[model samples]
Target: MRIGELARLTAVSERSLRYYEEQGLLASTRTPGGHREYPPASVDRVIRIQELFAAGLNSATIAELLPCMRDVDGGPGENATPWLEQELVAQRDKLDRAIGDLERSRQVLDEVIKAATGR
Candidate 1:
């Protein structure tokens, strides 16, 4: 399929798909007319990429991790390793800390709102 088809199937913008290719998170072949062509499997790949991004992984990190994942379910592939597991654990911990901080900030905001409302 073409880039536009992939974009429509994945519900991602053409610009984002191009950016994914540029970031090495996605792949495509160029046609004779210089248009981008993608394999049918790119749909699942794009979904996996979105999932990783949603999990707070950066493009570079996702690039390294992609080889270790199955496109269908984002499960570990043969290339998965203990080091990768450790890296994911660290990222999860960082997210946990950020969540805690955000919760505290929200509590403070709630208290301020309560006071301002005199209730």
Candidate 2:
């Protein structure tokens, strides 16, 4: 399919798709007229890329990890490298800390609300 079709199917912007290609995270073939043509599986690839980015992985790290990873039922898989595993562990630790901090903040907010309104 064309880039536009891939974008529609994946719900990713065309600009982001182009950026993925530019970052070497995605690949596309050129048609005879030089239009970008993507494989159907690109939809899953785009989703995986978004997930890695959400995990705080940079584009370069994503580019390195994509080949060793798979999008299985919207989950990450085939993670076979020690470095990648370590990175994932670090990201999880960071996420856990952020979640804990948010939870504490929410509790403080609840206390303030209860104290101010006597409710």
Candidate 3:
């Protein structure tokens, strides 16, 4: 499919798809006229990229992890290694801490809201 179709299917902007290519997180070939032509599987790849980004992994980390992941089921690929596992664990820990902090802030906000409403 074309870049626009991939972007629409993944609900991502064309600019982001270009950025992903530039980041080496995605791949594509050029048409005779020089337009980008992506494989159908690119849909899955883009979704996986978005999921990793949502998990707070940077582009560099995602680039490394993508090769180690299966776009279909997200299972570990042959390239998956101990060091990559360790890095993912650290990222998960960071997300956990951020979630905890956000929860505490939400609780404080709830208390303030209750006080303001005299409830």
Off by over 4 Å in 1: 73-76, 113-118
Off by over 4 Å in 3: 74-76, 102-119
Measured on C-alpha atoms, candidate 3 has an lDDT of 0.91
Error of 3 at 35 (Å): 0.3
TM-score of each: 0.84, 0.74, 0.77
* Per-model RMSD to reference: 2.0, 3.2, 2.6
Candidate 1 lDDT, tens digit per residue, 1-119?
99989989999999999999999989999999999999988999999899999999999999988877755755557787787788888989999999999999999999999999986
Global lDDT of each model? 0.90, 0.87, 0.91
TM-score: which is higher, 1 or 3? 1
Candidate 3 residue lDDT tens string, 1-119: 99999999999999999999999999999999999999998998999999999988999999988887755666657787787778889989999999999999999999999999987
- Per-prediction tally of clashes: 0, 0, 0
